[model samples]
Target: MIDVIGPWNRMHHQDTLEAMFRLRHQVFVEEMGWDLPLARNGRETDQFDTARTIYLVYRDEDGAVAGSMRLIPSVLPHVLGDVFPELCSGPVPRGPAIFESSRSCISRKARRKDPNGMIWGALTCGMIEYAMLRELDFITAVMDRRMVDMARVADWHLNPLGPERRIAGGGVVAVTMPIDTHALDTVRLQRGVPDPVLSLRFAGARAA
Candidate 1:
């Protein structure tokens, strides 16, 4: 299940958050070789993991962190605005209706079993659904070429903020993806999920 999170419930999921950090450490640092700060305790986190960050954590029946992603309000300091401003043609898009998404990851263990890319679809669809539910207009990010292509083929109303440029490992570009009912419908059709990817009926309680 994909669990939506906000400042209100962040402290209640310390254990899940820690597990997610560990999974991120394994995927981004150890496997992908990203030069991010490695916590002494082996969790991978940055200054961006703040109370304001909204998260969607995909966990299985046994409570394992299969995949996760986070959203930072554009009004706040975020990677696209502070670190990769050069990637875009002008000032990054910032407003109450737009948010910057980052730190998306899926555990290697989960990937090994998900050959159909269902997990990926679920995460992306859930993110879009969650954003629209919050009345957000769009979600922008600096994504690599492969991710850009995925968004393109997935039929997202993606608008490139700038041309793709050579980066450390490959090409990357800034993009703004719309979050609306039409986009959500297309994603559902593409993924063939009749119901919302998440059981988004939050009751102000811990996800079961």
Candidate 2:
């Protein structure tokens, strides 16, 4: 079985955090050919990997990082608002309720065997589950246009913030998705998860 958990306290979960970085390096730098700078130690990280970043990590039975995504508070310096302001027409959505999700990575090995798309669905559902636990309204993300169809199939309420634009990986769109029961159920069903994917444990908190 897969183990999914997060909004992990980075300070308290340093080992797991390191594993996540390594997985990101493998996915984004080695596989995707992204030009982003890697840490001298060979991990993919940036200014965004700060205290405020909340993460939802998917782990295999042995507890190795399989897939993961990072969530940043909209009010803080995030990719959608701070890095790609031109992508949105008006003010970027910012508040305690809305969060910006980015830096998603699913290991190549996992993808090779994820014929049912369960890993992707699980990560997506975990994000919504995290929002529910925190009483948040929704999540904003700069995502590849391909996800638009997945959102449709999964019954997610994705409201596009603006038109699609070409980015590093290809065409991408900004979207705001609600974190409500319908959305949650849709994601869970899509992932084949009968219940929650996120297992919460409090250590401390920070913002990205």
Q: How do the residues 37-83 of candidate 1 rate in per-residue lDDT, one tens digit apiece?
A: 64546788888888788888988667788999988889898989988
lDDT of 2 by residue, 1-208 (tens): 3233334445577888888899988888888888896454669999887766788888876678899989888878899998887778778899988889899889988888887878888888888777776777889988888888678766786888888999875999888988898998888777786576766634333221
Score every model by TM-score.
0.91, 0.90
Backbone clash tally for model 2?
2
- Give the least accurate 10-residue stretch of model 1, judged by summed lDDT: 199-208
Clashes of 1: 0
TM-score of 2: 0.90
Full-model lDDT for every candidate = 0.81, 0.79
Query: Which pairs of residues have clashing backbones in candidate 1?
Result: none
Clash totals for all candidate models: 0, 2
